[model samples]
Target chain A: MNDRLTAAERVAIARHPQRPNISDYISALFTDFFEQRGDRLMGEDASILGGVALYHGRPVTVIGTRKGKDLEENIHCRFGMPNPEGYRKALRLMRQAEKFRRPVITFIDTGGAYPGLEAEERGQGEAIARNLMEMSRLTVPVIALITGEGNSGGALALAVADRVLMLENAVYAILSPEGFASILWKDAGRSSDACELMKLTAADLKALDVIDEIILEPGGGAHLARAITFRQVDEAISRHLAELSKGKQLGRYQKFRRIGTAVPKKEGQ
Target chain B: MNSIFAKRRARLLAMKSLREHYVPVGSAAVCPRCGKESGHPAVAQNLFVCPLCGYHFPVGAYYRLSITLDHGSFRELYPKLAPQDPLSFPGYRKKLEAAQRKTGLNEAAVSAVGTIDGRRCVVGVLDSRFFLGSMSSAVGEKLTLTIEYAWKNRLPLIVFSASGGARMQEGILSLMQMAKTSAALGRFDQRGLLYISVLTDPTTGGVTASFASLGDVILAEPGALIGFAGPRVIQQTIGETLPEGFQRAEFQMEHGFVDAVVPRNEMRDTLSQLLRLHEKGGPS
Candidate 1:
């Protein structure tokens, strides 16, 4: 524990520009990856990419938040921040997975839900809310992997899964440490302090039971050892999928239902 | 010639004026929107809506229940379920203590079983005075249990939501509340029970994106702020001044997220009418 990276350092590693992203995992782990697009109600949102693919010869629906590998791509992906259509499109894919009796796998890596005027006008809140409600009741196995940053409702919208896993350096938080610092302390520069207090690192979340397991990354970061990181993550997902395929339905609902069962101390104690 | 745009702008102006400070006169009420002074008793008689401008004052959960529920029909649930410092985040325990002392509430939300216009329903209210009505783990648990109770008892559910967002002090655990409550509501929806979510002033962020938006019939109070992101955050992100009445209840209704914008004076009857219409048979 003494030599482990601090939460702030883990945050930086999770957000490293060259870190393995959703597309990398999809290419390495799945075959017959047919990229599906559009919410059908609206146009396409490139930020959230989802479609049908075959994993280990078993057909499954795969969805993930994608950030651009470079600057030009980042602008096109809205820096991995999704709009209403993006969430709607993900929901569309999840429902499709349920209909086809295929398991749903999602990768979460986002700054947050998009905070633009058009997003508000398009009912961003409703779209994400619809996902949380729909994903909870989907009668198919669902799994989520947090490979990088998982921020706020944007990340949780895709994460109401039977099993949630995170990479060693990945950080999943309610909001960025900078945003937390500015909101609470009124100073964004105290982000490192906020990061330490937030407990956003994989080990912290695992201890708190927020996430199920931590997929060990190669020393330094996943970017430094992409092949090994992919193998580790692939094995973790496959193991969880096999365990979840035993037809234990409604565990997705109860898994979340059982979190945070803290009872208050009675008065006059 | 009552154009829709004109009416919308006027409604926005009325809400903007409510943000101004009211004159503090003894035994008298000053209309925050119109700057007109009236007897305190008169304002109370009118249910706290400004007589001159129709601006509605933000009410506490208990006060809301007192007015909305049938007399002597209210029974509280989980009244002692206080929050603990799950993460030991800095300055969080003291903040909780201060909020508890100020709001006289164990948590931001209050859940109960009561009769609305003599019809049995489960009521949950988020008190904005308590940490700006943020959704902490305790708040989330209370509301989830309330929704489950409603489902088990075969009763209607009415939730008045007024929140700033997820409680930042609780960190990631607070964010999970959005999922927890939404999942509970999902199960409730399967029974085809009635869930009428009433959005009051300042419902945004996690609260807006969960049970508040998943209602069978979503209603909002006039001039209430309802959006995914707050106005200040959006303005800062976009570097542009927001349009007038942006994210207000009227704006949400216009954008089709809210069913209607019901004024404070008419909220009870409107909800009663909705509850009655959704009854299995004719109005009880």
Candidate 2:
């Protein structure tokens, strides 16, 4: 924890092009990755990549918001921003995970839910709402990892997990610092100052009890040492999953229920 | 001397009448959308809707309850629960205090158990005046408690939402409120109790993506703006002119997000009808 990176620096690292993405994590951490596609209600959204896979020889459902590695792919993935279908697809896979009793793991890396004409037309708000309600009650252990930029409800649509973890350099917030700055201060250029105020870094979230743990990245960043980052993530998931596999539904409820500062406790019976 | 005193009294009375004629005080209601002004009493009689253009005024939490609920059938809950500056975020405490002072609300939301047409239900209204009805830790706590109360008491739930989304001042804790409230609703949903969400003008952001959109039947007032992202952000992102009526209540209904665009006057009747229909026995 020496010479900690500034919040803005963390945001930059989180969005760094060379940083490891879901594809890299899926390939490095799991085997027998059978890629799934389509929301069944609409066309497949490549922004959210999900499928059943073998995790340490155990079958688990893996889902993540994917950013394209190149320009052409970025167009295909919409720079990792998901539409309603992407969220529905993730929900379908999570429901499938619940049915099969497979632990669900979701990797989050997105600016937010896509803010476009089509996304709104298709109940973008409802899609994310359904995910939050359903994921909160999932019978199986669910783990969400913030590997990079976890912005807005898009990151949260897939992140209502029993245990939410984040990479050392990852940033999770209600919205991006730039967006936050623009909305609150009416100036996007003040994003660096906004970053410091947003409390978005992994360490900040961890202290606030917003996240369960922080997966330590190698010196420089996860992009510099992908293998170390992957290993840390793998161990963290396994540890949390093992503990969460025992009666996790109520624990998930209590974890979020007790989070508020002004929640009043129940009176005498 | 008596004639002089009478003249002076008449002059003071005339000045008082002139002052009352020019200065309307809080007795005037100005329609922001239509740029028309009406007497406050007339607007109140119309359920706070502009008589000329039909624009619904943003009603506060208590005003919403007073208009919609059965007389003397409301009992407030958690009236004193207030927010703590958990993160000690800069200016957050002052903002909370200012919002509290301005709105007379402990938090953005007011939770209660009330009746409509004598049908008991748990009700909550988010006052946009209170920090833009943004969901902070306390607001979320109040909502979750209200939902859970409905679940436990076998009562239906109705929430009138008018939020700008999660409270940014509370940071991530405010974000987690979306999940907490939704989680409580998830449990309430399993009980088979009806949850009616009435979105007022400008329900967007994290609130819309959570409990506001998770209702069994989603309703919106005429011309309410409902969406996950604000229109400005979307416009800035796409760099294109948006379609007219985009994200409006009618637009949302046409897009199949909202079930109906109920007018302010008809909202109470519609809710009462829905509650009666969902009642245990046959419609009475």
Candidate 3:
């Protein structure tokens, strides 16, 4: 409660080393989590972690972008940036969930898809594009939570859900503010300003209707309270799942239809 | 008006018409990448694309529209959807005005309806010369309206994407366009209308994240730099040197990010072929 951080500092805390990752969430919430691998197109990517899991005795498919906590893990996880295979793997997992009529839960925390030549050669854009189109048609309930950095199409690929949630301190943006500053002002040092300008904080996203709900973290942020954060997130997911299950069986496309409509003119140009 | 080279030659020909410059094209100009000096009449004749190395020079939206559509068949839409600096980000208004002056456009992207090879489509092109065709509120609004119009008319839609991503001056307002444009495309998809995205040189950032990457049939011009983050940022983040031609058109196509890599010279024919295949009995 004492650590009142700026938006930029909160962004840093969001990516803090001590923060709980997706694996931690799985261990804390779900049981009998069987890991799934590969998109079955080319090869397996360690960046996307997904599989069948039983959440509160209900069969569910849990998928998300995984960033390793340490250097070796990060390397194994490709620093949380997925190749096309990771997206495809997620898609494959989602389709499986649909066949069994299971609700889908995706944990989005990535700096975006990998921007390497090899990744592009593997169909990164197409993978994301297909997710957007197919996820709209997914017949099962879908929920995405922004646990950390939700950046670009990589984060968005698994984020087309019926109800999108984010941690209070989490940040979801088209790209990192530093990237934005570098592209716009030719200086990455202006990133903090860009961060403020970009309005990437969860509250801002909620205001813009980009997210459905925000789960507040423990005092000082999620890192100071990993167990508590995990429980809060589990509660949020369970609540959203219950709501969506009771709601009519409509495609998630309805969630996006009203977004980004033209705002009323305010006498400016 | 009959030639793609007409506006390109307007400055050089001094009201003499494009024919006067055709003879001198062989030794006239130089390719920036290849550093070869030539008149390049074929380049002008082929939509200002460099003949030797396939370098795509910056093209204004009006000239691009003329080059892509049937002559005298384009009807511009939302030409006056001017932009306002909602955030009042410093110097944005000035830079926007400068871009407008240089490109002779109200915004970075222009929306219009036109007939290409007798197949009517809603078409728009981003002028690379206009703040590098960045997406502002006006740009997104115009494109959204264009998509909506295509949906209403039951027409195929084609857009040329050449942007430096979202307009930084607009801040999150610019980012919202990403969601807005994508949402509109979702509805467009429901209608089963064909939307072709043409990524030219340097399609990156927010633009790549949204509608540019959501095309039903995505196309890119040869040697265009296309991706979400710029090469420099990626390089810094990875601390590794990128491979040669990493984000080029060929690279994107091979990765399945793009459907086809069309050179500017053959874009019209390629688009026409695609249109004819997707056409549902020509307006029934």
Which is the leading candidate under lDDT? 1
Q: Which segments of candidate 1 are over 4 A away from where they belong? A: A1-3, A248-250, A265-269, B1-32, B35-39
lDDT of 1 by residue, A1-269 (tens): 11389989988998999998889989999999999999998789999989999999999999999998999999999999999999999999999999999999999999999999989999999999999999999989999999999999999999999999999999999999998999998999999999999989988899999999999988899999899999999999999999889865448878898777685635311
Question: For each model in turn, which proportion of the native inter-chain contacts is also found?
Answer: 0.74, 0.71, 0.18
The TM-score that candidate 1 achieves is: 0.93
**lDDT of residue B216 for candidate 1:** 91
Cα lDDT of model 3 by residue, A164-216, tens digit = 89998899886788877877788889989888877788887888777889998
Better of 1 and 3 by lDDT: 1
Residue B83's C-alpha lDDT in candidate 2?
A: 85
Q: Once superposed on the true structure, which residue ranges of model 2 sit more than 4 Å away at CA?
A: A1-3, A246-250, A263-269, B1-26
DockQ of each: 0.61, 0.55, 0.23
Instruction: For model 3, give the interface RMSD.
Output: 4.5
- Each prediction's total of clashing residue pairs, residues at least 3 apart in sequence or on different chains, is 0, 0, 8
Give per-residue CA lDDT, model 3, range B258-278, as digits (tens). 889987778999998989989
TM-score of chain A of each: 0.96, 0.96, 0.95
Native-to-model Cα distance after best TM-score fit, residue B231 in candidate 2, in Å: 0.6
